[model samples]
Target: MKRILSAALTLPLLAAVGACGAYGSSAQPSGPQPRAAAATASAGALPTAPGSVTIGSADFPESELLAHLYADAMKARGVRTEIHADIGERAVSMAALKEGSIGAIPEYTGDLLAYLSSASTARTPQDIYARLRQAAGAQGLTVTAYAPAQDADTVTVTRATADTYHLSSIGDLKTVAHRLAFGAPAPTRTLPYGLPGLKSAYGVTFRQFVPLAPTGTITQNALRNNTVDAADIFSTDPFIPRYKLVSLKDPKHIFAAQNIVPLFRRDVLTQPMADACDAVSAKLTTTALAELDSQVANGASPDAVATTWLTATGLAH
Candidate 1:
């Protein structure tokens, strides 16, 4: 969806958390292990199954595609694996990993940073990945090299509203603030990147704020039907393009960079596994991501879409 957050909005996400604790210490995975990583610890080590891994993904079409990609990539490495698609939000998914329910989960670098530490300054993708990897390590998780694709946060308005108000940036909404109603995830109303930044960066506040529908469809429909003037939408949402909505530029960078990364439990990042994941990250890209998303949005079965993509991209035989 969206890529890098401009420097301005990036601050809030960073400011919300402080320095992440050191990651060398990680939460150990649950269950029996094939081999012990060290002399005395049975936990926090990869299973000795040698060539098998489990990957988890969050809810949403893009995530499903990613899960497929990861599963396919690992399969190519001669690794047996399971794909746990739609594992809910980050917190829940991370919990799944921490509990050893799944070996690895895709995460956003900025999100992990915000979760680990609250500094808001702009950091290039490379830096973000390194930091996440290090922080994840502390929790007994490892952030594998990040992928090229980034589904950053986006604030969007109806195409009609944008044209009518000449609202081009988050700043422009200030003048017409009273006339607009914004809808976002329930948390955005109070979160750092939520209303506070709108007040701080744009000097504007909405006449009303509504809860984003539990599923994105409701929010998307609300925006289309004019039930809401604006709403939070991911940069790559197929509906954005399909509906011809106007994606307000986040010149202030309120949303953080959310590059896709695999967050692995200690058991999954053995050197060979890490290298296999890196290959997937290197090949994945925004354009490719958009295409995979479109397949599901267009109504193809997820498995069929994932299968086609894997073969076409040569990620799977």
Candidate 2:
């Protein structure tokens, strides 16, 4: 049987576990965090263990759904699994993993690598994963095969705004940006990959900066009402299609790659378990992820959404 443990119930249990060491200083990069490759064998494939497994997720819908996917699939393969959903940010969740409160969690490649090594210059998926494996290994964790699905921080505008400015990519925005008001999370106004990187990488300088919620109706409404010309939105946000918004391409890789992958503790991962998780990765795509997210946003439970996908892909019975 699978169980979804509440934070209140789980935090006390995890309090006795020692820290995995600080991920980094609190002055970490302020990038969008709530956010793969073809199916391949896991890097450190080991045999299935007879013991139970504990899975966890960060405090986000998509991540919670993924935790269910992993737990249900593992259970199908005869591993007893339970989920600790909404465990807070990556740092908090990672601490739980290190202390044995949980064994696995879904994670993004580039951001995880960045958290591990702030100085990492990895841009491509392969480069980022390689660096991530090394960094994660140091923390007693392992990154399994990555899914083809990817999500990134994107500069988005209404279709009308794109048409009016003849914008097809971030670079094109440079020409008309000076006349437009840009909106995004308040921290993005100064983050290295936010306004600063936008200016340096694409020569984009908006007429004014409009602070708005990162991914919600507030930002969408702002764009729809023309209060801001463009906003920083996640690629996986379903609102992009529903509102007919256009996401400007980032050829310069300003936001970096964020392919989905499972990050788990080394002791609990076996070859069979690794392969089972990889099967899920093989079937997930960016389009599929967005659609699933749409369902969750519309009030569907993450567990139900995940079970449907797993059954459809023949990963669960």
**Model 1 residue 17 lDDT score:** 13
Model 2 spans with C-alpha error above 4 angstroms: 1-45, 48-51
lDDT (10s digit) by residue, model 2, range 1-317: 00111122121111100000011101112232221122123343364464577899887677887888878887788778889988887778889999999999998777788878989998656667778877887888887777766655677888898889898678898888999998876877898778998899989999999877444566678889989988876666676667777777676777766777898887777656676777887677666776787888777888999999999989999
Q: After superposition, how far is residue 55 of candidate 1 from its true place, in Å?
A: 1.8
Candidate 2 RMSD to the real structure: 9.1
Worst 10 residues of 2 by lDDT: 16-25
Task: Provide TM-scores for the models.
Answer: 0.71, 0.83
> In the order shown, what is each candidate's alpha-carbon RMSD?
10.3, 9.1
Taking the tens digit of each residue's C-alpha lDDT, what string does model 1 give over 279-302?
A: 777666644665566666667766
Index of the highest-TM-score prediction? 2
Evaluate residue 292 in candidate 1 and report its C-alpha lDDT on the 0 to 100 scale. Answer: 63
Global CA lDDT computed for model 2: 0.70
Error of 1 at 222 (Å): 2.0
